[model samples]
Target chain A: MRDASEPGALPTPGGPRVRLLDADSAPLLVRDHFAGGDPGPIVASLAQVPELVGPTLPFLGAVLGPSWIPLREKEIVILRTSAVMGCRYCTDTHTVVALDSGLGRDEVRALRGDLPVAGAFSDAYERALISWCDAVAFGIESDIRPARAALDADDARVVELTLLVATTVMLNRYATALGLPVSVDARARLAEEAL
Target chain B: MTALATALADESLGGRVWFYTNYHCNLTCSYCLTESGPKVARRELDRATVLDLAREAKDLGFSQIGITGGEPFLVTDLPELLAELAGVLPVLVLTNGTLFQRALLDRIAPLGDADVSLQISLDHPDPVANDVMRGPENFRKVVEAVPALLALGIAVRIATTLEDGDADDLPRLCILHRSLGVGDEDHVVRPILRRGRAETGDMGVRARYLDLPPELTITADGAFWSPFAPTVRGGSLDTDLLLSRTVRPLQRPVDAMITVLSGRPEGADSTLNIR
Candidate 1:
């Protein structure tokens, strides 16, 4: 039985169900994308959507790839959404991605769902963005309108951020269901970055 | 070296290419990932770009194609686009399954052979839950479209996303699918992605990252790493995850995501939902 940290491992007792796609036989594109690396269970389970993969792939790209939202703004919403949704893979991955994007160590902590009081967040827009995402993440529909207002609806970035939040939230459930495991190296890297 | 590096070095392409047929949908489902609905802005790759991606996928040895969007059928020239795409690779269109009425189906009926299929969404067996899951009257159209589409020689499959309390509804939903002529095997049950309206309004929907699916996407925007990303919001070049501006070659960000996604197989469980 592979441990919980290992991809393709058996599900721990009482965990959400999981299924794997055969790595050797996955479509050539998927195999190549993982660089013939461990194709993880998430990749395996996508066999569940073979027919829909083509259609659904681009939405992921549009939201995760590039859009009207700026990188910093996008990350803030994503990190906040990840926290609300309890998606570990997103929180960890975005932390590294945020650090790579030049966020300070403390700011990264703020993104991990910590209190903003540690001087972790410096940008006013980011602060407002966090509040809005927090509202959105917890399913406070009415609160979202005000949060959206505070973030500035007139600015195009806010609109894009709304989309980003929506997209990440969807992915949060899918990723959580698929069980994206984190790497030991990634853990070490994120720890170092936070330091 | 990580698996992502190894995967990138192989230089293969087009196993399964996802094209955003368009970025608008007829319905505004609360949990939509793209925020697609009638009122949303329309963003679609032009005909030339679709053809360009098809050429790239064909040359790269892509196996098949998946066409997705607000509603793939909403593209003004869906039939023409499907014909062109199916000409290059086998194509499947993921839809709410509400668009194909008698007239629209007649226009594109020729491509219904092995080249195409439809994966339609239905939430619960009851019209009320499903209607609420989708929007106003979504359930009836999609449910009714299934047998009609199957009659057109088009393969039909049921795709459902179950929330926390929604699993008990699955067996019944599968039964409902059978009543509509779809078998249990033809029904695919999945978890709701905490997106769009779902994220803001769904307290029951759970979320965590899945290992990056080894899939590539193309559109007017650019080549992307994976659809299951946190999304870079900008004009295009400003984002780190844009794998390429054109289909020519992938940039480095693809490698970055794959490395993280390929890590820790043992951690692949829904319990990773960190509080």
Candidate 2:
């Protein structure tokens, strides 16, 4: 299991203090940044939870590897989707990875809702994806009829991809609610590599 | 914009158009709505078909057109598509910032000359939270991408989804945005849409506050307005969907909110209402 403070971990500024779960009886740190109230129950519940990182990380790695989707495209969707969901922590992390994946500065800016279509994406495809993101993030009921019909063999993969993206959004909310801070050193390392 | 405005206000009479390119993406987040992947089928809309749809949208008087799927950038000829659409009406594209290249940037740079805007998603204000949502290293990637786009002279806006209990975090996010060079005037903060995996998650402290009505009336353009204000333009559709079988004359702001919140039947009841 990964401890709260690893060798290269960077302390989150103004973020929550993370206490690694060592034993079953260890007290959990439940208070989160987004959740306004008590953190006792939340932290206790998560504390000492076994095998917390493996399943999620490996599953995500397998599903998002080169065989599943291009590294660049996957990163772009993840970064933008996280942004839309208001998961700032996720957005910051994904943005760095996106740059490392070969996306340029202009492309990153566009992900923040700049030009109607991103430079690398098709206009029609961009419209469909953005609308879907908005619909899901905003809780708006969307008629995906156009998106469905527009999908061809090449685009059918989106169905699975959408589930992955949605899952990440869920995780972001959960993590933030629990008051987990960004692994500072890791984020910095990524930024350095990407640049 | 008028067509979008009209459709958002009235759900019954317009046509909906969707364009899918591919499912390939650069990041691997825990929750993805499309379940996108690289090996999956590559069903995509060709250039000619997209052009045809644009013409159809104009003919139908359907004011809204949406494009989506995995990462649309995996397609090779995106610049051409944008150039063609530039001649048509308004178009909006949703994207993650990973696939953007300088060549493509040059090709689509002209879109600003036409009426086109891009809506990017940034879930959290903090770098760690944002990266955790996508995958390791994604936070830095998106951060770097922002300044690059700004350098191109593109107008960028940040959209943050405010989950229940996340309201207070807005100021924190705003501060983060400012640090990244995003002005308060240019960013957009929104509430989280409780659907998909979100419905199954913690419901948070605010979840109990969401008072869901029944039935929602969404216009063709995708706006959920109040159904009680004599018009369904900005009203909630939940109240209308559950209370009335027909499109009731929107009369009050409160009534419209009831309708809009309840418009999407699935998971609406589970949403955390935090005022």
Return the top candidate by TM-score: 1
lDDT of 2 by residue, A1-195 (tens): 223344344434544444433222231111121144222322332433312322344565565556556676667667677777766566666677777788766566566455444464655665456556555555544545544455442555766567656766775686566555555644785576552
Separate DockQ for every predicted complex? 0.02, 0.01
TM-score of 2: 0.40
lDDT of 1 by residue, B133-156 (tens): 788777888777888887778788
The CAPRI classification for model 1 reads as incorrect
lDDT of 2 by residue, B189-223 (tens): 65543322332343222221123221222222221
Off by over 4 Å in 1: A1-195, B1-14, B203-212, B230-275
Mark the 10 consecutive residues where model 2 chain A has the least summed lDDT: A25-34
Compute the DockQ of candidate 2. 0.01
TM-score of 1: 0.51
